[model samples]
Target: MAVTLKAEKREDLNKSVTKQIRESGYVPSVVYGKDKESKTISVNSIELVKTVRDEGINAIMSLDIEGEQPVNVMLYDYQKDPLRDELLHADFYMVNMAEEMDVEVPLHLEGEAQGAKDGGVLQQPLYQLQVRSKPADIPEAITVDVTKLEIGDTITVADLPEAAEYEFLDTEDTTIATVVPPDTVSETDEASDEDAEPELVGADGKDEE
Candidate 1:
């Protein structure tokens, strides 16, 4: 389900004005579509945070603008306070529900790998997958089960299950996760091997002076 948020048109576009808006407890934002001009607006900070937390970045949202019909949008970009982690600003991309759009959706790895349980290290190189799908059909996330994976085993983009509504944009060969054997030698062991001296002996099998 698409989350709904209320917004009011904003006239101020300066940095100072935005800063003041943030101080007043509203998140300044912009909405733009390929067919329409961008418009600035503001939403309640508390409401915006809740909506994002509940819907995530992949889901479509309905923005109810004052005096206008609600528009469908997706979270496109955002900024945060470096020290406070507060949301500074956000940009919502107006989307056509019937048209396909490309987006990056998070990949969730589920279940413990058998190799990892047996002392092999598990690594995940890709945390998200790029895909193209209609706004209404976008998935919140993709799950990859690693329970059966063994040491040296890998799961790639090609291994993902087929979703009829989605067209994966990532190359099929991209690796998603893997398990590998643990190291057998320590730095101390390597140094000892390098420093050990060979035994010096005479031709008659006696130790040389």
Candidate 2:
């Protein structure tokens, strides 16, 4: 499901104009494509964020323009205010139904890792990956099972599930996540770790003395 938002034409194009627009509760944005020329537009920051909140950032959108043609696009760049955490701007890229489009889908790790059961730390490196597939066949998130992953176990890019239309753009060497074993504590290690004795030498600070 897509959240539909209402937008109006924005005539301002400069930085000052954009700041003013954002102050007025609007997010400045643009829509462009290989087939058409670039367009400047704006949306309500609150509504726009809400529309993309439930769905992932890469979720497909149906943009409803007032009088112009309805456009199908995916949310691209969304700029935010670092200090205030405000939505400042957005960008949309046109989607073609005929061609295979490359997109990044969020990876969702499922199940407690077996390594974790053994007091090992589970680390997931890749957050999202670029996959080529049709818009309709695109998935919101890719799920990876981590139950069998033990210490030193790695799930590479090749380990991901396969879909007929999707193609991975990353190298096979890319590591998605892994588990590391916890270091064992020993009596000797604890004694040596905390106690340090300083050797005194006559008029010199040297072990040779």
Candidate 3:
């Protein structure tokens, strides 16, 4: 179910007006979509933050605009105050339920890798996955199990399990995770120390041959 968020249309584009809106605990936002005229609006800051916190960033929203029919939207982008870390502005994109869209979904790794347990370093190269699916079919996240991975083994995009709901956009050769042998810096340092010659010291604390 889409979360409902109330919004009010704003006609004034004055800088002072935008400042006042922020001061009044509202975030100035714009709603837009293909083939539709963009609308400027304002939403309650507290409610907007709470909604996004409860729902993932990709959660569909029912934007209830005053004097207009409610529309389905997704939070497209946002800006925050660099110093205060407060939300300053937001952008919502209206989405068609039947139309396919490209989005980035969070990627999660589950289970400890066998290679890591055996002293190998496990690395995740990709933290998010590009996926294409309809609005209703979009997944909250994609998880890959790493329990079977061995040293020098890699999990690529092609290694992922097939899903009917969404399609991965990344090329099959793109690596997601891998396990490799641990760094040998300590062994190299030990060898270097063993090969070094001790320097003779003089009474003045200077190196002498």
- Residue 7 accuracy (lDDT) in model 1: 93
| Model 2: lDDT of residue 141 | 84
Report the C-alpha lDDT of model 3 over 91-175, residue by residue, as the tens digit.
9999999999999999999999999999987889899999999998888889899999999999999999888988999999999
Error of 3 at 148 (Å): 1.7
lDDT of each: 0.87, 0.80, 0.91
Top candidate by lDDT: 3
lDDT digits (tens) for residues 14-44 of candidate 1: 8888888889989889999997999999888
lDDT computed for candidate 2: 0.80
lDDT of 2 by residue, 1-209 (tens): 55566666777788898888889998888888877888888888887888778776777777776678778788888777766788877888878867888788888899999999988888888999888888767777888999999888999998876778788888988999898766532554587877967756676432210
Q: List runs of model 3 lying over 4 Å from the truth.
A: 184-209
lDDT for predicted candidate 3 compared with the true structure: 0.91
Candidate 2 regions with alpha-carbon error over 4 angstroms:
14-16, 184-209
Backbone clashes in model 1, listed as residue pairs: none
- Cα shift from native, residue 154, model 1 (Å): 0.3
Give one clash count per candidate, in the order shown.
0, 0, 0
TM-score of 3: 0.85
* C-alpha TM-score for every candidate: 0.85, 0.81, 0.85
